[model samples]
Structures are given as C-alpha cells and as structure tokens.
Target chain A: MTLLSVSNLTKSFGGIVANDSVSFDLNEGDIYAVIGPNGAGKTTLFNLISGVLRPTSGSVQYAGRDITGLAQADIAALGVVRTYQLVQLFRQRTVEENVQIGFHLATRGGVGAALFRPGWVRRQERMVREKSRELLRLVGLESQAGLVADKLPYGQQRLLKIARAMAAGPKLLMLDEPAAGLDTQETSVLGDVIQRINDQGITIVLIEHDMNLVMRMATRITVLDFGKKIAEGTPVEVKVNPAVLAAYLGEAELE
Target chain B: MTLRSTISAKPQVWATALAIAVAVALLAYVFGRGGYVVTVMGFAVIYGVFVTGLNLFMGYAGQASFGQNAFAALGGYGTAVLCADYGLEPIVALVLSATLSAVIALIVGYPTLRLRGHYLAMATFALGLITYELSIEQSGLTRGFMGFSGIPPLGLGRFQLLSERAQLAVFILIMLLGVWVARRLRGSRFGRALLAIGESEPAANALGIQVFRYKLVAFVIAAVYASVAGSMFAHFVGYISPEVFGLSMVTLSFTMLYVGGIGTLWGPIAGAVLVSFLPQLLRGFRDMQDIIYCLALIVILIFVPKGLASLWSLAVRRSDVPAER
Candidate 1:
C-alpha cells in the first residue's frame, strides 16, 4: 500500500529553491532512502513532509488524506514523525523522561488529572512509564535510563533521539542522518534497529549521506541534485542510472 | 520514567518535607500575631503563591511572562467590585475573579504567545502595562488611583477571619496548596511535555505534543494562580490598588524565581521568603536597601548560578557519599 505520496512538492526561500517538483511514493513496510550531496535539499524535503515547513506548491498525501499545510503536531498525531539531524532532545531530562515526553501522543492524562492524580491517572502514568522503559530497552539504553540525556555519549545521544521518536508510535518514521556521528559498530547496531523497526510493520524513510550504509540498507533509493529529482529506483537499478551517475560523479561522466 | 522510581527510591525526602511543613506551620501560628513582622510574612506567603504560578510558566513551560501581576490586579479588582460594590460573599468573589482572570489569559494568550523568546516577553510586558492603565483609567469600575477599600475579610457567613494570625493561617494553607499543585504538575505528562517544549519546541511538536495548546494551558493556569493570590491579598488587606500589581511586583516575582532557583521545587518558596524579608532587614540602611538586595542577588548568582537550590542538591550529594578515613 502507498502509505505516503508526495507530488510536485516545491519549497523556495526567496530566490533559492530548496525543493523543486520533488515527488515520491513510499509503500508500507519498505525502507526508502533519499541521498544527495550537501545542499541537495534532502533535509528540506523531510521538513516539508513532516509539516515543519509548508511547500510553496503541491501536496502530500498520507494515508489517503491531503496533509499539505497541517501543523507539525497535527501531522505527528496522524503517525508521521521525524527525528532531527542535530539530535534535538530534552537535555535536562533523564533518558527515560525524554522517552516519556514523546509518549505525549499516546498518553491520555491532562492538566486536570495531573493536578488531581486520581487512580486512573496514576494507572495511565504507570503504563506510560513502563512503555517508555521498554522503548529504552529496545534502543539498548535501558541502563542509561536514569542518566540525564545531555550526559549521554555522542552515539548514545543519537540513539536516545531515535528512542524518543519511536515512543511517539510513528507509522511512518523519517530519520535524518541517524548515523552521522557513529562508529562502524554503532552504525551496524543502528542498522539492525532500523531493520527491526521496519519488520515491526512501520514504514521507514531516511535522509542519509553515508552511501555504503544507504546502498546496503535501502530497498529503494531517490536521488536529488540542485533541488530536483535526478533518478529513483531499487538500489541496484539506481546504482547504474546514468542521471544518478552524473549527479554524483560529474557532468563530464556523461561526455 | 525515572521520576516514579526516584520518588520511590527516596521515600525519606517525603518524611523530611512533611516535618518541615509542620514545623513551619507551627512557627507561623505561634509568632504570626497582629504585628509588622506577621504582616511581612503574610505578604511573603501571598507572593509565594504568586511566584509559584509564574515559575510554572517561566521554569517548566519555558515561557517568560511579565503580565502575571495584571491578572492579580484583575483578581483583586474583581473581588472588590463583586464583594464591596455588589455585596456578594467574599469567597465567591475570589473564585469568580480567578475565573475571570483565567478567561482573560486564554483570550490574550491566543494572540500573544505566538511570538517566541524575547518577542513573547515584550508582548506580555505590554499586556502588563495595558492592564495597569486600564485599572487606573476605568475610574467608575476600578475607582482610579485612589483605590478600592472596605473589602470584606475572607470567611464564610458567620466566621469572618478577622486577625492577622487567622489570615496568615489561610495564606499559609494556600501557599502549601500552590506548591503541591506545582509539584504535581512537574511530575505529570503535562509537565514533561512542557519541559520538552521548553528544551526544544520543534522536538516537542514532532512528537505530537500540541505546543500552542499546552502553552495556553500553562498561561491560563499561571494567571488563575496570580488572580487567587491577588484576591486573597485584597481580602487580607481590605483594600485594592493599581500600585499593588504594577511593574515592581513583576520584578519582585521574577527575582524570587531566580534567587531561589528557576525550576526547582523549593526554589520559589525559598526565594519568596528570603527576598520578602530583605527590605525589612535592610530598613536601617535606608537608601542602601535596594542596592544591598541587588548585590545579594548578584552574589548568589555568581557563587551559585543555579540559585539557592543548588546548595540543597550539593548537600544531598555530600550526604550520599561514604565517609573516608
């Protein structure tokens, strides 16, 4: 099933076009990756789809609903969530607290219940706490749950962001540079986690600069250059596409 | 999360808190007779409640608001108009006035809170100025700068709380209630979301936490708190004045939050008590009182940047360490 469909999406900042006429279809249970050089507008595309930025023109259809200009929170409530490129997290909070905050969408208690602390609210809070812990374990940070988020190591901090995003119960998870700062071992672990998440029936879309990781992990690949789609196909097909070659290599490659 | 486990892990802290609360209550009852000292302490309790509400906005929810005192004025004036002019019961006036303040907050927050950082601060500052002007200019309603007097004391039909000790007792109870509410907020999902928004708004939004709605809720709750405190102040003093809820009160409340520590549970309480007593203590210094107070705050910030709460945490850490030979 086509879980997310982006058609003719265009975004411009004054004279600079960040994303121009970019279109793609992501199917359910597939790992899709978008790769381009620096300034290829990969991150901008993620922002546009996640409702952090509105496109100058075109539409984004998620689960058959046109969610072009919806608020970021509204879109996230609909199960489309994204992690940040720079590891945006609640730094003063514990790792578990970071995850629990992400459970805002799944949890049901409000300010009134928080003030009163009735039995039902306590029960719901307990459930959220347990779920947050389970997510920590899933991300292999169960022991670090008590440590403050900013105190975590660089690679672990990245995993914390992913764990937080997972706690949001995203149906379509868009990861921005999840492996940017990780070593080989950490990258492999992250790849395994991503595969596990995909196997659990969540669609995955990522913007990654690591070509080897993307080529090895992504089932389908979309290539962008200068704010436009150059080529897109299964990784094997995209590896041999002439347009992708020229975009990645040099224009002289075609000559 | 770790919050539940930490609460369970240190059950002894609750015992300490209970003991301290009891001791403070007993001391207040013993010494809070009708005198200048009791009056200062009474004002401390009132402002404690007021600053606790502001802390919820600035510390937890991460919105710096300057218009909180305006809500207090609304509360005081609401009670004055209802109780003194319309002859309604004082307690009913308090509740209605608090509600009116919250409604006004909701209406104002919708437009004003969209501005971020310093912009939001300036807008709320503007709100404070506007409300102050309104209170003075609307002479028929607010009685202009001459103020509203003869407001009835807080009490039920037959049991009017007449003495300073009686009023101090009520203020203490309300202050405790405000602290309790703040603690509850800090541990809940609502508070966690607010903290998340404070730390990074885009992160909170991506997680589907409704940032705007939560900010509005925090704003209104803080407004109601300030209103209740204001109403109680009016009833306690039997008068209302625009000068009571002006820029000076805003500075005092902000100072309290900072001096004690912005986000700590006991920061506002400690800040309120310490700052409220400074003027009285410095009375002999006369012209040097404000200067001394500012210098004290600077010293505290320099030595303990996190506010006085850091000292408590440092002591806790030391106590947790094993003794060496």
Candidate 2:
C-alpha cells in the first residue's frame, strides 16, 4: 500500500524550477533509491517531501493525510524524518546526547517533569540513554558514545547521523547521501544496516550517487535528470532503461 | 569512579556552591553599606536578572536582541501606571507587566524571528528605538520626557520595602530566584533544544524541534525578565524615566553578557555586578572613568571572547586535574 503519495508537485526559486510536476508514490516497507546526475533536484525533492520547503503547487499525502505545507517539526513528529546531505550532528554534544535529542518528540518529560520530578526525570533519562546506546551499537559506534560528535572520524559521524535519525522512531527514513564519504568497507556495513532497518519494517528513501550500493540494495529505483523524473521501476528495470542510461549512467560513463 | 567522570561531576557542585557564596557576600555587603551602595546593588541585581534573560536568547537560542530594555521599560512603566493610577498592588502590577511583556514578545517575535542573525539584530534594535520613541511621544500614558513619578513602594503589613536594607533584601531574593530559574532552564530539555538550534538551526528543525517556538519562548522569557527588572527598579527608586531604558542601558547589559559569558548563567550576574559597580570602583579617576571602563571591556572581549565564565571554567579544570592526579 502507498504510504506517501506526491501529485503534481512543483517548486521554483524565482526563475529556477527545482522540481517540476513531480509525481510518485512510495509503498509501505519499500526501500527506494532516487538516483540522478548533479542538479537533478533530488535533495530539493526530499526537502519538499519533508516539509523543509513548501511546494509551489501540489499535494503531499503521508499515511493517507494531506501534509502539504506542514512545518518541518510537525512532519517529523508524524514519523517522517530526513537527514542532511552534510553531517549535522551537534558537534559540541556527545554522540549519545546527539541521538538522545531526537527523542525529544517522544519524551513525555517536559520542563515541569524535569524540574518538579527528579526521580521520574532520572528514570526517563536513563531509559533514553539506554535507547541511545542501543542505537549506537546498531551503527557500530557504541564505544564512542561519550565522545563529542565532531571528534569522531568522518565515517563514524555519518553513522551517528543515521543513529540520530533512528532515535526519532521514524516510520519513513530519508537519507541524503549517506554513502558520500565512506570507504568500501563502511559502505558495505551501511548497506547491511539499511537492509536490517528495512527488515525491521521501516521504509527507506535514499538519494545516492553510489550506483553499486543503489543497485545492490534498492528494491525500487527512480531516475531523475535536470529536476525531471526520467524513469522509475524495479532496480533491474531502471538499470536497463535507455533514457536513464543516456542521461545518468552515460554522464557517469563520461566522468 | 573513573578520573574523567569524577572531574566532570565536581564542577557542577563547586559552581553551585560558589554562586551561593557570591550571593551571600552580596547580601552581607548590602547589610554592611549605607544607602547609596545598597541602592546601586539593588539596581545591579535587577539588571543582572535582565542580562541573564538576554543571555539565554543571545547565548543559548542564538538570536540577537536589542529590544529587551524596551520590555524592561514597558514592565516598569506598566507597573507604575497600574499601581499608581489603577490602584493595583505592587506584586499584581509586576505580574501584569510580565504578562504584557510576554504578549508583546509573541507579537514581535513571530514575524521578526524569521530573519536570520544580523537581520534579527537590526530588526530588534529598530524595535528598541521605536519603543523609546513611543515612550517619549505617548505623554498621556507614559508622561513622555517628563517621566512618571509618585510610583508606590512594595510593602507587606507595616514594613515598607522602601528602605535601603529592605530593597537589598528584595533584590537578593529576586536575584536568587532568577538564578534558580536560569539554572533550571540551562539543564532542561528545552535548553538542549535551544543549544541545538544555536549550533545549527536546520539540523535542529530536522530533529523535530519547533525552532521558531523555542526562539519565541526564549525571547518572551527574556522579555519577562527585563520587565520584572524594570518594575523593581522603578519601585526601588520611586522614579521612572524614558532615559533610564535607552540604548546605553541596553549596550551596558550586552557588555555585561559579553564580559561574563554568553551561555553560562552566572556570567550575567558577574557581568551585571562589574558593569554596574566599575564606575564607582574607579570613582577616584573622575572624568576618565567611562574611558577606562570601555577600555577594560574591550580588553576583556579581545582576550577572552568566551567571557569570564571561560576563565572560571579553566581554573576549575586545572584545580580538578591536580586533585585527581
């Protein structure tokens, strides 16, 4: 069943059309990849879907409810979460603290709770710490929990971003270039983790330039060129499409 | 415990105890000195609360605001008008002033906070200028340039809090409450959210934090602090004037925040005491006092951009390491 549907979505910045008449439906539990050449507006589309940017004209229905023009925080609270293309962990905060911040929406202890009820707040904080630790373990950064996020190696920072997003308890996770700076071994681990997260029933949408990881892990693939969808299908089908070949892979071939 | 853990935990206690000690010292000074010192200390405590509120906004939420003094003026004038004219009690007037300041914050913050960094600074600065102009022109309500007089003093039963000692006691109590509130905010989840937003707003928004709401909350909370300070100052001195809440007071408060530390709670208190009392300390210099004060702040800012709080933290760190070693 379709978990999110976008119809006739259009976004423009003055004269530049970043996304034009884009239409797509994401199925529940589907691991989808959006692949494109540079300036294909993949990130812009993610921003629009995630409510960081309002669509110029169109509708976005998430979990069968129209969510167009909702605030980013509201969208996130609805279990739709996205990560930045650049690593955006709180550098001064510990890795565990960074992840625990994502639990703010789920945390029942407000300012009053933290102030008036120390025992309750301590218990809740401990629970959040345990959850953060578990997520850090899942991302293979359990030992680095106490370390400041910026002190981590670049690869670990990327993994921490994923762990932070996971701490939000997302129904749908959107990652922007999670594999951008990883080595082959780290990429393999990330692929495995993505599959594991999907196996646990959360849907995933990723924008990536890494074709090998995309082809290996994506259940469905959408190809974009110059802000327009060129082709979309099952991984093999999109891989064999001539338009996608001419526009995307052909450019990759040249570079 | 591990040495690292032990060192990390020691600072929290030491810091709290040290703050309480400083507060006690201030209390003792108020009791020891005569009227003039007590009066200045009263002003310092109120301004300390005002600057503490601003520190939360500028240091924690990463929003630059110059209109906090405007809110202070509003609270001062609001309380004066209510109690003197409308026959409300002093405490009721203070509460009303805070609520009014919060409402004004909501109205102003909603639109202006959308502007980024320097734009926010310029916008709020203009708002402060406008508020000052309003105070000057609105003669019927604010008494314009002539200022408001005949403001009533706070009292309970037969004891009027107008005397220097009583004023100091009230100021100390209020300052302690302000510190307690600021400390609470510093450790709360909302405080973390503010810091996260200050670090990177987009990342904070993506984390499901309502960045605008938090910013508004910070702004309003700071305004409330300023307003209460204004009310207390007006009553303590039994006089109110447009000149009392102007750019100079705002800049002085900002300088205090800079000198003390941006995000740390005690920084404002330290800054407030220094800014308020430095001229008196240098009273022997006569005409050169202002120049000396400015030079001192410039030097402090140049050498310690993080403020005096960093120096305190560094000292604590050194002491902590040696003890652990």
Candidate 3:
C-alpha cells in the first residue's frame, strides 16, 4: 500500500525553482532513497513534503490525506518525523533526556499537568523513563545516557539524532544526510541502525551523498538533477539509467 | 530533564534543602520584628517567586522577556487599586491581578513569540518602560510618585495575616511551592518539550512540539508568577510605587537568575536569597560595600559561572541517585 505520495510537488524560492514538479511515492515497509548531487533540490523536496516549506504548486499525501502546507509540527504529529542533516540535539540535555523530549507527541501533558505532577503524570513519567532507556539501548548510547548530548563525538551525535527522532514514534522517517559527518566505521554502524529501525515496520526515506550506503540500504532510489526527477527505480535499474549517469558524472560520462 | 533528580534526587540534597528551609524559618523567628536580616530574607523569597517564573521563560523555555516587570507592576497596581480603593479582599485581589497579567501576556506574546530569538525581549523592554511610565503619569488613579498605600493585609475573608513572622513564613511556603512547580515543569514531557524548543526550534517542531504555543504559554505563566509576587510585595509593605517595578526590577531579577543559576531547579531560590543579601552582607565595609559587592559578582561569575545552584552537585556527586518517579 502507498503510505506517502508526492504528486506534482513544486517549490520556488522567488525566481529560482528549487524543486520543479518532483513526484514520488513510497510503499508501506519500503526504504526509499532520494539521491542527487549538491543543489539538486533534494533538501528542497524534503522540506516541501515535510511541510517546512510551502510548495509553489503541488500536494503531499500521507496515509491518503493531503498534508501539503500543514504546519511542520502537525506533519510530525501525523508520524512523518525527520532528522536534520546537521546535528540538532538539545546540546545541554543528557542523551536520554534528548530522546525523551522526542516523545513529545507520544506523551500527553500540557502546562497545567506539568505544574502539579499528579498521579497520572508520575505514572506517565515512569513509562517515559523506561521507553527512553529502551530507545537509548537500541542506538547503543545507553551507557553515555548521562553525558550531555554535545559531549558526544560527532558521529555518535548523528546516531543520537536518529535515536531521538525514533522516540517520536514515527511512521515515515525522513533522514536528511544522516551520515554526513560520520567516518567509515560510524557510517556502517548507522546503516545498520537505519536497517534495524526499518525492520520495526516504519517506512524510511533518506537523502544521501554516500552512494554505497544508498545502494546497500535503499529498496528504491529516486534520482534528482537541477530540481527535476531524472530517473527512479530499484537500485539496480537506477545505477544503469543514462540520465542519472549524466547528472552525477556529467554528460561526458556517456562517451 | 529536571535538575530536581539529576542533581538532588538523592537523600543528601533533600536534607540540605529541608535544613535550609528550617534555618530560614528559625532565623525569621529569632530576628523578630523589623530586623534587617529578616526583612532581607522576606524580600528575597518574594523575588525568588518572580525569578522562578523568569527562569521558566528564559532558562527552561529558552526565550527572552525584558518586560516581566510590566506584569509585576500590573499585579502590584491591581492589588493596590482593588484592595485599597474598591475594598476587595487581598487574596481575591491578588488572584484577579494575576489573571489580568496572564491576559496581557497572551496579548503581547501572541505576535512576538511567533518569531524566534529576542524579539519578545524587545517587546517586553518596551512594555516594562511603558508600564513604569503609566504608573507615574496616571496620577489620578495611581497617585503618581506619591505612591499607592493602605493596601489591606493578605487573608481569608475576615481573618487578617498581620504578624511579621507569619508573613515571612507564608512567603517561604509560597516560594517553596513555586520552586516545586518549576521543578515539576522541568522534569515532565512538557518540560522536555520546552527545553527542546529552547535548544532547537526547528528540530523540536519536526518532533511534533508546537513551538509557538509552548513559548506563548511559558511567557504567560512567567507573567502570572511575576504578578503574584508583585501582589505579595504590595501587601507586605502595605504600599507600592512606580520605582519598585521599573527596569531596575528587570536588572535585579536577571542578576538573581544568573547568580543563582539560569536553568537549574533551585536557581531562582538560591539566586534570590544570595543576591538579595549580598548588599547587606557587605554593609560592614561601609564606604567599600558597593566596590566589594561588584568585585564579588565578577569573582563569582568567573569562578562559579553556573551559579550557586550547581554548588551542591560539585559538593556531592553522589551515586545511587534514584530515578525521579
């Protein structure tokens, strides 16, 4: 079943068209990768779909409902959570606390309830502690849970971002360059972490510069060039597409 | 997470806090009426509540507000006018004043809070100054620089709370309750969401936290706290003037917040007590008091940059700190 569909998705920044008529659909339980060179409108496409930016003209459908132009928080509440390309962890917060904050949607309590901390709030907090600890263990940061988030190494911080986002109880996880600053060993570990999360039945969409990771993890690949979709298919087919080849290696690659 | 457990979830910290509270009460009792130390302590607790609210806005929520004094003035004036002029009960007057402050906070926060950064501070700065001006210029109602007096003592209907020691005790109780609320706020899902917003607005939004609503709510809550503190101040002195709730109040609260600790659970209380008494502590130096006080601030800022609230953690990095239940 189609979980998310972007139909005729277009976005323009003043006169510059950042994402020109981009369209894609992800099936339930499939890992989708959107790959492109720098300035290929990859992030722009993510922004439009995630409701961070309004499309000049287009629509984003999640679970068969139109979600374009909705608030970023509202989109996230519908289970379409995304991690930023750069690390955005709450730096002063401990690792476990960082992940617990991601449980904003999963837990229910407003300002009033937070003040008194009645029986229900305490019970809710106990569950939150257990659940957050479980997530920390998942990403293998449980030991460093007491350390402040910024105190972590860069690659581990990236992994921490994933753990935090996962705590949001996402149905569709959109990762923006999750492996950007990661070393080779860290990158491999992250790939495994992404796989483990995908196995838990959440659909994954990622934009990546690392072709190897993309080819290995992505069940489907969409190629973008100059704000337009050049080609899209399974990893094997996208690898051989001439337009994708020209876009990545320049048109001279064909010769 | 709330510093409540992260630092003081252990028994030692609890004992330290209880001992401090009891000592305060003891001192208040021994000092009796019109003692300088007791007066300073009483004022400290009032400012503690005000700064506690400010901490929620600036420390936990990660927003700025220069106009909190505006709300304080509102509470002070509201209580004064309602109790003194209209013959309303002091308790009812205080509640009414706080409610009015909340409404004003909502009105101011709605637009300024939408945009991130210190825009709220800019708006609040104007508000604080404007409120100060109104108190001076509205001579017909407020009596201008002559000050507003004859505000009734706080009580339940016919019962009057007139004793100096009793008032100090009540101040301590209310201050403790305010700290408890702030600690509860810092440790909950709501608290986590707020700190998340303070750290990274975009990331927080992508995680399903409503940044605008939360900021606005934080702003209003802080204002209500300021309002209540102002009302108490009015009743404590039985008079109030425009001079009390000016930019100086903002400066005082800011100093208290940083000196005590910006984000920690006990920061406000620690800061209020210490900063309130710092001037008095140096009074023995007479001619050098101001110089010594400024030097003390600089030294503390350099050596204990996190403020006195963090002193306990350094003193006892105790193990087996039970998780907050």
Candidate 4:
C-alpha cells in the first residue's frame, strides 16, 4: 500500500520552477531513496512533500489523505516529519533535551499545568525523558546525552538530528542529505542505523548524493533532473536507466 | 527517573530562590536605613519581573520585541484609568489592566510576530512609538503628558501597602512568584516548544510545533507580565506617566535581560539588582556612571556573551569533572 503519493506536483519561485510536474509513490515499509546531482531539485521535492514549500499544482496524499498545502507543523502532526540538509539540533540544549523536544507532539500539558507540576505532566515528562535516552542509544550517542548538542563532532551532530527527528514518532521520516559530509566509518554507522530504523516498520524517504549507500540500502530509487522525474523503479532499474545516467553524466555529474 | 524525583528538581530551584529572597530581605531590613533604599530595591524587583517576561519572548521564543514598554504603558494606564478615574479596587484594576494588555498583544502579535529578525524588531519599535504617541494624545483617558496621578495604593480593605517596608515585602513576594513562574515554564513542555522555535523555527515546525501559535502565546504571556509590573508600579507610586514607560525604559529592560542572561531564570533578577544599584554606587563619579555602565556591559558581552549564568556554569563545571569546552 502507498504510504505517500505525489502526482504532478509543481513549485515555482517566480518564473523559475524549482519542482515541475514531479510525481512518485512511496510504499509502506520501503526504504525509498531520491538521488540527483547538484540543483536537480531533490531537496525541493522533499520540501514540497514535507509542506515546507507548497506546490503550485497537483497534490500530496499521505495514507489516502490529501496533505497538500497544509502547514508544516500540521503535516508533521499527521506523522510526516522531515530533517533538514543542515544539522538543526537545539544547540544550547543538552543532547537529551533536543531529543525530548522532538517528543513535543507526544507530550501534553501547558504553561499552567507545568507551573503547578501536576502528576500527569510529570508522568509524561518522565516517559519522554526515557524515550529520548532510548533514541540517543539508537544513534550511538547515549553517552553524549548530557553534553550540549552543538558541542558534538560534526558526524555525531548529524546523528543527533536524526535522533531528534525520531522523537516525533513519525510514521514517514523524510531525511534530506542525512549522510552528507560523513567519513566512510561514520557513513557506515549511519547506514546501519537507517537499516535498523527501517526494520522497525517506519517508512524512510531520503535524499542523498551518496550513491554507494543508496545502491546498498534503498528498496526503491527515484531519479530527478531539473525538477522533473527522470526515472523510478527498484534500485537496479534506476541504476541502469539510460536517461538517468545521461542526465547525471552529461551536465551534473554524480560524485 | 521516577515521577517523584522528576517533580522534585524544579521545586528545589524555586525553594532556593525563595530562601535567597527571604535572606536578602532580612539583610536589607537590618542594614538598610531609609525609605530611599527600600524604594530603589522595590523598583529593581519590579524591573526584574518585567525583564523576565521580556526574556520569555525574546530569549526563549527567539523573537525580538522592542515595544514591551508599550505594554507596560498599557498596564500603567489600564490600572490608572480603572482605579483613579473609576474608583474601583486596586487589585481589580491590576487584573483588568493586565488582561487589556494581553488582548492587545494577541491582536498586535498576530500580525507583527509574523515578521522575522530585524523586521519584527522594527515593527515592535513602531508599536512602541504609536503607544507612546497615543498616551500623549489621548488626554481625557491617559491624562496626556501631564501624567495620571492619585492612584489608590494596592491593599486589602482598610490596610494599604504605603510604607516602603511594606511595599518592599509585597514586591519581594510578587517577584519571587514571578521567578517561580519563569522557572516552572523553563522546564515545561510549552517552554521546550518555545526553545525549539527559538533555536530553529523550521525544525520546530517540522517537529509538529505550531510555530506561530507558540510565538503568539509567548508574546501574550510576556505582555501580561509587563502589564502586571506596570500595574504594580502605578499602585506603588500612586501615579502613571507616558514618560515613565517610554524608550528609555525599553532600553533599561533590554540591558537587564542581557546583563543577566536571556534564558536563565535568575539572570533577570541578578541583572536588575546589579544595574539598578550601579548608579547609586557610582554617585561620586557623576557623568562617569553611564560610561562605566556601558563599559561593564561591553565587557560582559565580549567576555561572557551568555551572561552571568554562563559564568556560574563555568564555575560549577570547573569544580566538577573538568569538562571539555
């Protein structure tokens, strides 16, 4: 069954089309990968699907519900969450605090209840705290949970962002360049974590320039070029498509 | 940890603050000799409350607001008109005025909070300007630049908080309450949401946080706090004036927020006490007081941009674990 479906989605920045007539379907429990060279609109497609940017035309359906043009937060509330290309951890907060913040939707109580310290709020808080620790362990940063978020090494910061994203309890987690700027060892660690996350029944959609990781981990792959879908199929089919290879090699070469 | 231990952490902070406030009050009563000292301390406490409110918006929510003084004016004028003109109970005046300020914040923040960065700052600054002008132009209601006077003292029945000692005690209680509220908020889910927004609005939105709604709530809460402080000021002084809540007051509150640190619960109080007394301490220096204050602020920003909390944390870190920078 399709977990997320986008049909002919188009986004324009004035006269420039960032995403043009893009269409794809993500199935439930599939580790889907989106790959393209620089400025091929991979990130823009993520933004449109994630509701950070509204499509000019067409629609996005998540679990048979139209989510097109919904506010980003509202989309997230419906269990569709995205991570940014750049790490966006809450820098001043501790690593665990960053993860706890990700549990915003799961937690309840407001300013008045918080001030009074009611039993329910305290219970919810404890649950979130324990869950945050569990997430840290998943990202292999459990020992660093007490440290400030930004103080983590760059590769660890990327994992921290994923841990925070998971705190939201997302059914569909869309990651933009999660493995960007990682060494071979770090990338392998990230791949292992991603596989574990996918094994747990959460659908994963990611935009990545790391071809090796994409080939090894993706159940299916979609290729985009200059805002249009060039190819979509299983990883093997996408890799051998003549149009996909020409688009990458002729102008924007994939590293 | 279990629920019992988790709940204990926040209360411990508030208990410590209460203990410190009581000790400080006792010390002042014993060592301080005159009404002037008490009045100064009272104003310092009031300003601390105001700055703490402002920090909730600017520091925690990651929004800049320059027109908090306008809300403070609304607060002062709200109480002044309700009590001095209509002869209502002073406590009633306080509640109504603060409500008025919050309603105005909701209306204004809806549009103004949408603008980010410097644009939001400019918009709030304009709001301050408009409020100041309205206070001056609306003569019948605000008494214009001539000032609104003869506000009844805040009290219960026949008893009033007129004496400096009584006012100081009341202000201390109120300030401690404000501190307690801020501390509780810092640990709350709402506070975490605000901090998330402050750190990254886009990330917060992606995490299912209603960014604008949270911002509006923070703006309104801060507005109400400013209004309450103004109400306290009006009843304490028995007067209200536009000049008292103008550009200079905005600058003063901003300085306090910075000197104390933006997000910490105790920063505002420490900053208010220190900055409020600096001029009095430097009385012999005459014009040099302003220069010294500016220099001290510069040093604080350059050396410890995180404010006094950073310094305190550094000390604590040094004593325990020799942590990495």
What's the TM-score of each model vs. the native?
0.88, 0.84, 0.92, 0.88
**Which pairs, if any, clash in model 4?**
none
- For the predicted complex of model 1, DockQ is 0.52
Docking class of 3: medium
Where does candidate 3 stray beyond 4 Å?
A118-120, B1-34, B115-118, B318-325
Which residue pairs clash within candidate 1? none
Question: Per-residue lDDT tens digits of candidate 2, residues B201-285?
Answer: 8788778788888898889989999999999888887889899999988888988988888777787888888778888888888
Clashes of 3: 0
Of the candidates numbered 2 and 4, which has the greater DockQ value?
4
Q: DockQ for each of the predicted structures, in order?
A: 0.52, 0.35, 0.56, 0.49
> Model 1, chain B: what is the TM-score?
0.90
Q: Flag the better candidate by DockQ, 1 or 4.
A: 1
Provide the overall lDDT of each model, using Cα atoms, as 2-decimal numbers. Answer: 0.86, 0.84, 0.86, 0.85
TM-score (chain A only) for the predictions, listed in order = 0.96, 0.93, 0.97, 0.96
Off by over 4 Å in 2: A1-30, A51-75, A92-94, A108-129, A141-148, A184-196, A225-255, B1-4, B11-30, B85-87, B140-143, B316-325
How far is A50's C-alpha from truth in model 1 (Å)?
A: 2.9
